[model samples]
Target: MTTGSQRTRTVLHLPCLGPDAVPLERAVAAVLGYARGRRWLRFRSPGRPEGRWVRVPAFGWARFDAHPPSTGPDADVLIAEGLHGRLDRTGWHAVHDALVGLAPVVEAVGARAAGRPFWELPADEFSVLDEPGTVGALLRHLGQEAGPHPAHVLAALHHRHPDLVPHLTPTTRRALLPHVEEGDSGVEAVVHRELRANAGAFAELEAAVAAVVGDARPGRLRLHDVLLWLTTTLRLAHAVELGEHVAG
Candidate 1:
């Protein structure tokens, strides 16, 4: 589809990076640990025709996306293109800061796009996925326009957040985009149980992320994202072991 910017865009779910033996989740945590203190972190104005300077995080994820295929107008794509060199030089920690700085703008885009089908929003708005808490707002903002698969909210969160990237990677949004969306009691129960069981771990991860990002802890939706990601990863892992794809 063409983005509102009128640029043709395609969305693709790339395979998780790195060796199969090292789960994506664990690799990201390690990247964060390595990046702490040693890397430069700052929020800079997004670059335009010629960019400004910013320190990049040491993580490969940042550097990698900083140079995505030159075909999309999504926010993350634009941001990545804007910060291409800076990200390559600097890395994930800096990219994380950039995403955080971009959060409000992304949310604003969602607010404007509210009540419209997601695809109808400007392509740049899809970049909201790269930020921490905007997708839920986007989904809620979508209201009736969220269509038949609001569980795609989980996919959005997983796509954006580094911590959830590998573990919850979906080759296609359709894989996780629920047909009958939820508000169902069964869904609520599962959410509650996952939250309870993983509360301590989530707390630790949040604290770690907060410390690294130099911000208040991420919002509730982002936290819930962790739980949803974990649940999805477990299912996906099982499917992999069974030599079958996850059921859409």
Candidate 2:
């Protein structure tokens, strides 16, 4: 991990992909199992936006249909690690902003996709994230909402960039809002605080994941695996706090 002005950046040393590695499904199940005896987390869904919230106890299951970073274990591992690398240095709020900013476009693309998978879109389409106009567009979308919850956009970004695991979503707010309601710091502030304090443990976990998954450096997948792991860890931790039972 490399520390910068605001936060630490992670350089993932993923394990090599090979037949000897634990099967992808098994690895996914292990992560999801951590959610056992935990509460279900809710988030706004890109597919159903009519004031509907999706439940995610674990990303492995689909209440309706699957989302991105598909079952291709190689792709999943790659994307997860790529996201991990990004989150290592990015302040939680910056990540929140980027996701929120990108929500409108993700929704727009999904609408046009009409239930198509995100990977179906040509690579050229994803270039929109780098475009300057997107920022202006997001502002316009948020302006029309009542008592706008700006952080919700961060949740919506998951539709396409599943690699960018959500942090400021409605689900996370369940855990963080009490603090804010009590005139305390927001969720990201607290999580980042805890994460920084226990950086060594997280580092060890990262290495463990690499060993379990494959120790090769992340490639096109980037830090998706890391983000997935982080998101799961947050969910499980909050669930325990709520004393929610794991799904049967």
Clashes of each: 5, 27
Deviation in Å, model 1, residue 86 alpha carbon: 21
- Give the range where candidate 2 is weakest over 10 consecutive residues by summed lDDT: 10-19
Candidate 1, 145: how far from true, in Å?
2.9
Q: Model 1 has how many clashing residue pairs?
A: 5
TM-score of 2: 0.30
Q: After superposition, how far is residue 221 of candidate 2 from its true place, in Å?
A: 16
**Which lDDT tens digits does candidate 1 get at residues 1-248?**
12223211211111221112333233224323322212355555545535445665443234332233332223343343332233333343444444444455445644564655332333333333443334333433432232232223222222354231211223222223442134322122222333344444444544544544443344323444332343344433332232211111
> What overall lDDT goes with each candidate model?
0.34, 0.34
| Runs with alpha carbons beyond 4 Å of true place in candidate 2 | 1-58, 61-166, 180-185, 215-248
User: Where does candidate 1 stray beyond 4 Å?
Assistant: 1-144, 147-192, 223-248
* TM-score: model 1 vs. ground truth: 0.27
At residue 142, give the lDDT of candidate 2.
36
lDDT, residue 78, model 2? 29
